[model samples]
Each structure stands twice: as structure tokens, then as C-alpha cells.
Target chain A: MSDLSVDLGFLKLKNPILAASGTFGYGLEFEPFLDLNRLGGFVVKGLYYGPREGNPPPRLVETPSGLINAIGLQGIGVEAFIAKVLPKLQALDTAVIVNVCGASEEEYVRVVEALDAEEGIAACEINISCPNVNKDGACPAFSPESTRAVVREVKRASRRPVIVKLSPNVTNIVEIALAAQEAGADAIALVNTFLAMAIDVETRRPKLGNVLGGLSGPAIKPIALRMVYQVASRVKVPVIGMGGIWSGADVLEFMIAGARAVQVGTANLVDPDACLRILGEVEDFCRRKGIERLEDIIATVKT
Target chain B: MFKDPEARIVGKESWGDYFLLTFDSPAVSALARPGQFLMIKVSDEPYPLLRRPLGIHSRKDKTLGVFFKVAGIGTALLARKTPGETLDLLGPLGKGFNIDPCLAGKPVLAVGGGRGIAPLYFLAWELRALGASIKILYGGRTQADLPLADKLRAEGFDFACSTDDGTVGRRGLVTELMEDEIKAGGGSPPALVCACGPDPMLQAVALIARDKRLPAELSLESRMGCGFGACWGCVQRIRRDGKAEWIKICEDGPVFPAESVVWEKESP
Candidate 1:
């Protein structure tokens, strides 16, 4: 079998396929669908300092080849996650990455510091990119300065590798990516979700209760690829890419575009076992092409 | 375990804008209960990217059925599917109608409003199997909409129906029909009420349940991103412990007690 493992410098992943945050819940929700150990890792839903109720109804709307969602980062808080979810996750053989979120830089540090004492957490993907919440311009991923500030704080508080998740709704994605890396982020995950929205023509009101949401799915794959390619070309840290990955071919495209690993986001909603299926496809492609290792193909995109 | 099976479509039936497609999947059919639903990937393509959530209509042996209305691009794609084709289905998901054994030999009522009637048929069948005397209140916009009325009759189910245009059974809303039954009986109301339908219809049913002191369970509808709890896409405002919270409808319920439902406020 062609080797599908990936190393992001700080830690080694059995494979490049990961279940993205928000889409994968707390990972335990999928225990009945697939073996968690089979995946490289899965990022749990974004957790703040305390439990949040998230947004109101009409949180999701499907567009052409995409889904716009404003789930507002509802979660069970860092304490509950450590108390309830971590024990079950520790029993499993998979890497459990925490997607940390906060209303402020202090909250982010607090969450990371709390998680520092936890054992099962493999890494912390700082979720400064979610567009569904942080309406007060608090989304750190929107600006390089704020991105650097939060990533620096989180990296300091986190004992595990810190992965900075970036947003595409910015003027300069590469600049923001570089900022995260400079802040000592062990890795960078790009293209969280493009800011988008939909409308009900009959009622003339926004389809999402939040009026605007982050769009993810097959529709945004090409744009996400371009961003990952651009950012990976410059940033020194390993780049983790995601945004609308549906199949194994899609994951391969991200890797080829310079992403060391790819996270399957919206596809998880389409099929709970999408990661396994995509991983199989990657394996088949590798074997068919006589490629022995996935690392040999990272950033192999022809100029 | 929740299974995502590529279930082969074994049967198909159509009536204008409505259709019923049956698929053979032991995983889903075995675990499926009344009021549960399935999220079907309508097309291999991504234009209609999200899976369409359809209520489980029937379950016999290893086959399951989904009754749906071609309301949008997703359902339209699903309607074009023919027998022998396959559908990617993720189910038997969400909390279904609670079927307590005490319901046996008791008066049970099932209500459906148009396509909302999808899950009620399976509910009626299950209730009847438990020796409960089942009565179904089915309604739609016109005669063409109440396509399952004859099917329900053929199965020897006791039912009543209504349409807005007076094309069928009663000449008004199904809620009106329910009110008439309660008043005309001049006796104890049904022991339990199970309903699936448009929000307004469900709201009316909840109201009826409230006034008559009858226990009611409602199967709600939402535009779901995933039929499983992972997406957090489908949520409903529900009251629990005297406080209303946004509950994930895909997991916590597609079925909820009528009293817990926080209905939309009627326009002034």
C-alpha cells in the first residue's frame, strides 16, 4: 500500500484526511459511523470558555454546490469537553484535536491553558476564522495583526502543536498566514469558509438567521486551492487546507497545491464516512499511479 | 449503528408533484421507527450539494420507503430517480415517534398535512400493530395533493381528510376536521395524537392538544444540512425544564412533544 501518512513537523498524522471542526461535532458523534482511529485525526466543534447556545433557526441554506451556515459556534465549553468528551476520546486510538474559539484574546488563552492540562488532545486548531460569529470585528483571522496576536497567545498557552485556521474573507490571505506562522503556530489551516449568504425571493429576507454565513462545499474548492497554493508557497510551517473537499480527488488536489494535509469539511455532512471513502480513493490513486508516498506529491502542481 | 448505505431503489410510485420511492437496506429498515427520517444524496453532482431530508414512510422486512414532494432542486432530482437505481441514504436518524406499549388498545390519532403526512403512514401501521385503534387525519391543498388517501383506505385504515378547494373529503383544513371529530364524538378525546405537517397545521394541532388535554407528539420539518447531529444545522426552539433552548432537531428530535414546541407567533 502507498504510504498515506503526513507529518506537520510537530506531530505525525497516520493520513492526510481529517474531519474539520463544526462539521464533525465532538468526534464521538461519529463513533457509530466509522472507526475514529482509521482517520488521521478529527477536530471537534469550536469550544469557547463556556457553553454557548449558538444562533437561531434557519442556520443553513444550500446554494449551487455549496452550503452557507451561521451556526454561531455553539459548544459545551472547554471544561465540559475535558470532563466529558476527553475521557471517551482518550480510549480511542485517534488523534483528538481541539478547535479553540473565544470572544477575546484572553478567552483564547484561557481555553488553551485549560486544554494544556488535558491529555487526549493532540493539537489545538485556533478557530479565529469562523465567520458565523464575532460580528464585532473580533474575528482575528480577518487581519494579520489580530491573527498574529491571537496565534502568539494561543501558542504560548498550548502545550500541543498550535494550528492557526485562516479565513478567506480577507484582503491578503498569505500575509495573514505568514503572521500566524511568525507567531509560532506549528501549522496553518486555510480557507475556513468564504463569507456568503442566500435569500428567500418570496419573503425577500435572508435565508440564514444571521443574515450572512460562511459558505463551504464543492463550490469553494478551486478558490481554496488557489489560496492554499499561494500561502503554502510562502509560509515556512506546514499548511493544512480545507473548504469544500468532497472526494479523494479533491483531497489530492489540495495536497498537490502544497497543503501537507487536507481536512474534509462539508463532505462529512454529506456522508459520515466520507473521510474513509476519500482516504481509500487517495490510496487507490496512489497505487494506480505507482506513487509510494504522499509526501512525494506535496506542492507538485505544475507552474 | 447509524449506517450510510447505498440503498438500491426497489420500487417507485408517483402522483403529480408527490412521489414515494422504496429502497432495500436492512440497516435502515431494521432500526427505523415511526417519525424518523433519512438524508438522501439526490445527485452525485454537487449543485444540490446537501442531502435532502425525507421522512421514513414505510418499513417492511428489509425495505424502506420515503414519501416526498418535489418542492425544490433536491426533491426534484430525487423524483427523477427510477426503480433499480441507487440512493445514498444516511439514516434511520433522529428521534422518532415514541410508541409506548401502553398505547396498545388505546385510541390513537395520526394527522398529516400534505407532504407532512409522509411519516404518519408508518406511524399508523406501527400503532395498529400494537392493537391500538388508529385514526388518521390527512389533509392537503386539493384532491391531487391527498394522493395517499386511497392507499390508506385500501389498507383498511380509518381516516378523514380535507382540502382547501373542497376537492375531497371535508371542505376545510384538517384541523377543522379534528375539531369536528372531537365535538361530534361527545366523548373522551383520543388517548394520544401524533402529527406531521406544515408549521401552521402543527401549531393548530398543538392548540387542539392543549385545549382538550390530549397528549400530542409532532414530527417537525427543517432544512437540514445533515440528518445526523454533526452539522448542528437543523435545530428547533423547544421548551425543556420550563426554559426554551435551541435543540438540534436532527438528533434531539424530528419528533417532539407538542407542548415543548415553540410555534411561530401569528402575525398581528
Candidate 2:
């Protein structure tokens, strides 16, 4: 049998499959259907300083194969999450990676500082590329300077490992990845949702209430894979790949392409038990291939 | 919520390319309401990664029936199954129609078009038992498209029928038939108009209710992920203030008041 354990400097995962933020909804939501402890880890939904009701109506639109959403980062905020959501999540056996988002660099630091004080939070993933929020014209993680500054500040404020989630809507993702690595980011999660929009042609109006939305699913798989390959080759920190991963074969493809760990996002939207199914398939694939450890597959590109 | 470990396919019937599947899931039956639906994984394969959403037609004992059209690979697989087979199901989800107040000795008109009639049948049955005066208005492109006409007639419902081809009853849209009913009933209108159909049809009925000043409610359909509030996949636009607010149709409603929906010339 193949061993699926992996190490990312400060944190360790039993396997390479981790639930992406937003899709998993703080781990508690999936507890009824999924065994949270069996998988590697889960990244909770993005948190802000204050409670937010999020954007207005028509927040989501279904495309031919995927979905576009403009949810506006609606959440109960850091204080409530710590008080209510955190305690329940902490009880789970899985490693917890809280995803933090903010309108300004200072807000990011403040949220990180609050989370650092909480117990059972294994790490924090800095989301600098959420397309839903309007306070920031574009996510700060899109630019190298802003990405570095946010990473440096958060790393300075917390002792926990900070994983900077990079946006795919950029001129060169490697530049942003390298910048995060240089500024003391413990790891990097590549390819947040691509900026997109849909139209109700008959009405000549935008389908989503926000007019613009973030696209995720099988439609963006090729782009996400290419970006992961690009960033993994350029950055020294471990890379967590995401976007359109539906099965174990897709996970292996991401591992071969270069991601040390892969997160399942849109697939969870389609199948609530997708993460568990994918994890089982990965173990079966490893056993069938006679692989001894999951680390042997990371960044193992074939000519 | 307990998982239905046994993927038991309790029953199956064919309606053209569509299939009416009944599964033995005590968990789903125990929780399901009249208009809620289930997300069924037709195949364990990854090609069709998402489960197809199907409305719960009826629930009895420990079994829940789902009515679906074979529009894709998932439905096609479901149609091929026998009564003894098992299919994976996750369900009894989404907010159903509110039948309590409407059933208080009030005259209720249940309107449906095409496959949309599935959920309304259960609602009508529940209303009848509650002693509400129930009238069913069914519309289809042709007589053949009316999948449950015989079942409705057998149920002894006071019904009106219309078809686009003039094959069965009136030769216009179901709305034309509804107009006559509204005229005869005078300005008071029926106690409520409960409708479920295509988006265009629902939009038309909503407009009629607004013009006639009739109390109306509708069951809306959208592609969903979690079938619960978590994924935010099945969101619909509703006017809260002067602006629009996104609400999860699966949770807040598959049912909404007619006045709240902002219907466009096209769906946006």
C-alpha cells in the first residue's frame, strides 16, 4: 500500500487532497456526509473583520459545464467564527486552515492576528484574489508588490504558517508566486477563480447580480494546471493546486504537473462527498501503481 | 442527517424519454416535504461528476418517488434501472411550498405546464385532504406531452386542460384558460394561485396575478449543488429594498411570493 503523507514545512497532511475554501464551508457543513478526519485538511471560508451579508441577488449562474458566482464574501466575521464555528471545527480531527480575506493589508493583518490567538487553527491561507468583494477594485494578490506586502504583514503578525492564495487573473503568475515566497510565505495556493461573467441574452442583462463573477469548474482546468506548473517550477515553497479536479486521475495529473497537494473546489459543489471519493480513488491508484509514498509523485514531470 | 447506506431502487416507470423512479430511503422519506427534491448520482463514474436534481413527486411509507426527464447521461442511466436495483441518492432538500394557510377553507388553483406539474400534484393532494377547494390547470405542447393526465383525472380533481397544438382542449396557452376562470370568479380571485412550470410560463402567471391583484405563490427551479443553503448554487433574485438581493432558492424557497420575483423579458 502507498503512503499518502506529505509535509509543508510547518504543517503535515496525511494525503495530498485538501478541501478548498468556500466550497467546503468551514468543515462543519460536510460532517454529516464526509469523514473530516480521513482526508488531509480543510480550508474554511474566507473571513473578514466584521460580519457581512454579502452581495445582492442572482449571486450564481450556471454555465454549460461549470458555475460562476459573485457571493461577495458573505460571512459571520472573525469574532463569530471564533466563538461559534471555530469550536465545532476544532473538535474535528482534520487539520484546519482558515482562509482570511480583507479589503486592505491592515485588515488582513488584523484578522490574522485574531486567528493566531485562537486555538486549533493549524495555519492561515491569505486570499488576496476574491473577485466577489468590491472594496478592492482588484485583489491585492494580483500584483507582486501588494502580494509581498500582505504576506510580509500577515507572516509578521502570526506565528502560524501563511499560505498566500494567488489569483490566476494576472500578467504573470510566477512573478506573484516568487514575490510571496521572497516575503516569507510558508506556502502558496495557486489559481483562485478566474474573473468571468454570463448574460441573459434575451433581456440583454447580466446573469449575476454583481454583473461580474468568478468562474470555477472543469472549464478552467487547463488554465489552472498550466499556472500550477508555472508557479511550482518557479517558487521554493510548496504549491497547493486547485480548479476542475473531479477524480483521482485528475489529482495524479496535478501531482505530476507539480502541486505538492491539490484542493477540490468546484467538484464539491457538484458532489458533496467528492473529496472523500477522490481520496479513496487516490489511495487505490497508488496501490495499483505500487507507489510507496505520495511524495514520490510530487513535481515528477515526465518527458 | 443519516446516509441512506443501501442504494435501493424500489421502483421505476417510463414516460416517453422520462422516468418516474421510486427509491426506498426512509431517511429521505422521513424528511421530505411536498415540493422538495433529491440529487441522485446516476452513475458512480466521474464523467458525469454532478448528481442530477429531481423533484420528489410523492412520499409514502418509507419510499420517495422522483419524476425526471431523460435529458442527459444521468437520467438515461436512471431510466435503465429495474425495481430491485440501487442508485445513490442525497436528498429531501430545498424549501417546499407552504400549504398550511392556503388550505384553510380557501379555493386553491394549482397550475402547471409540462414536466413542472410533478410537484403540484402532491401539493394538490395535500390540499384536498385539508378540505381546500382545489382546481388543477394543466398545459402541454400536445396531448402526448401531458404525462400525468390520466393520473390527475383518476384523482377526481376539477381540472382544465390546454395544449399549443389544439390537440386536447383549448388551442392556446394555459394562461388563456386561466383568464376565463379569473373572469368567472370575479375580482375577488381564487384564494391563491399556486403554480410551477417553465420560467416563461411562471413569469406570465405572476404578471396575471399582479394585474388581477390575486394572492399568488410559485415554485421556482434552478440548477443546484448542495441542494441546501451551503453552496449558494441555486440563487434567485428578489427585491428586498429598492435593489435586488440574492437568496438561495434551495433554502429560502423553491417557493416564493409572486410579488417578490423581478421577472424580465428574459431570464437574467
- Best prediction by DockQ: 1
Write out fnat for all predictions, comma-separated.
Answer: 0.94, 0.32
Interface RMSD of 2: 3.2
Tens digit of per-residue lDDT, candidate 1, span A139-187: 8898889999999888778778999999998888989998998899999
- Residues A239-290 of candidate 2 have per-residue lDDT tens digits of 9999888889889888898898999997776677789889889999989989
Output the worst ten-in-a-row residue range by lDDT, candidate 1 chain B: B259-268
Error of 2 at A147 (Å): 1.4
lDDT of 1: 0.90
Model 1, residue A259: what's the lDDT? 94
Write candidate 1's Cα lDDT for B17-40 as tens digits: 999999899977889999899888
Q: Interface RMSD, all models, one decimal each?
A: 1.2, 3.2
